[model samples]
Target chain A: DQQVKQNSPSLSVQEGRISILNCDYTNSMFDYFLWYKKYPAEGPTFLISISSIKDKNEDGRFTVFLNKSAKHLSLHIVPSQPGDSAVYFCAAKRRGIQGAQKLVFGQGTRLTINP
Target chain B: EPEVTQTPSHQVTQMGQEVILRCVPISNHLYFYWYRQILGQKVEFLVSFYNNEISEKSEIFDDQFSVERPDGSNFTLKIRSTKLEDSAMYFCASSGDAYNEQFFGPGTRLTVL
Candidate 1:
């Protein structure tokens, strides 16, 4: 299913520039949105999350903005570091029976920060 | 930090053989899940387990697939008579509760010959 989508397959930014990765979803029932970072041959690591009640959430140099009207979300990283190079995946969560909720994930966007 | 752990990082078996993938969820987590990612595809949910029973499952999870928590800490996914389409990376995940943030383990790559 294409409920969640990351249209950008890859992104490149200079070390000191701002990096932006975008995501979109067709499901309105999704109440929670999260970003995950993944390295080669490794499991995805949780980075940040935002609840539907809020439009923006920030952590350190990373920020996530959700536009409910557009059903779109974007992750921004400032002063991008080389360490930030990895595949970023966007996921959404909906309430499920007995609380064993499952996640719907988007195709990952590979972010590369060049020094 | 507490994290989910998986065994048999990689496995190769005949298409008709049965295979079991094992995982150890975080100690304090109460929910468990399995998701698979085929090459060059999005991660898809297989099933969710809670209180020793399956609470939810996806269309991808059919008669050939089953999940079990035989003990307190271990979770296992068994595929009966695997198919070539079943070759993919299987990830084990745990959350503090349903619809909560989840922690994932390094996936086990299953290759069906």
Candidate 2:
């Protein structure tokens, strides 16, 4: 079963506009959430992350907002640039006692920023 | 910034053959992990290793699959008997600590015939 889900498979936005990608999770145990951006043929690059204790985290032009009650989170890119076009994967982790926490990933949303 | 590096960007092997995928995680990172993605599918966790031993593994990582940190720099995943379903991209990742962001390699595409 997909514990983390990104229902929107694709999104298109104009350059210089805002782009919002949403994700939902079924596991309430997940306490840490992150967003990664991947380009064609390249490994995923970390973009932003938020801890359960916080509702929002901002890094440069990217911002992640989390709503624990809704089991949902979103990544917002302001004044989106063409370089922002990539597949965005939302990941979550439930802390474990012994080992590194395993990440549950969404199907990924392909964001296209039109020039 | 340090990044994870994986070898043999692509590999083709016969079913039932043994195959090993190699990765060198960032030098100082302590936690290591392996994840796989089947074509057109979401990425799935395989296993995690630390301090030279496996810390956790998924159901998909069965007896046929094993992970080891053979040395200070190299971490490896070995599939004792490959199957057609084994064709997928294997990624290596590392994190400095638990609950920290992970750095991923470009990925190794394994095609088992």
Computed on C-alpha atoms, the DockQ of candidate 2 is 0.73
DockQ of each: 0.73, 0.73
* lDDT tens readout by residue for model 1, B1-113: 99999988998999999999999999999899999999999989999998888988999999999999988889999999999999999999999888668899999999999
Indicate the docking level reached by candidate 2: medium
- Could you tell me which residue pairs clash in candidate 2? none
> Model 2 Cα displacement at B59 (Å)?
0.4
Off by over 4 Å in 2: none
lDDT of 2: 0.92
Stretches of candidate 1 above 4 Å error?
A: A96-100
Model 1 C-alpha lDDT per residue in residues A1-115, reported as the tens digit of each score: 9999999999999998999999999998888999999998888899999989899999999999999999999999998999999999999987543563888999999999999
- Lowest summed lDDT across 10 adjacent residues in model 2 chain B is found at B48-57
Clashes of 1: 0
What is the C-alpha local distance difference test score of candidate 1? 0.93
The TM-score values for the models, in the order shown, are: 0.97, 0.98
lDDT of 2 by residue, A1-115 (tens): 6899999999999999999999999998899999999887777888999999899999999999999999999999998999999999999997644574888899999999999
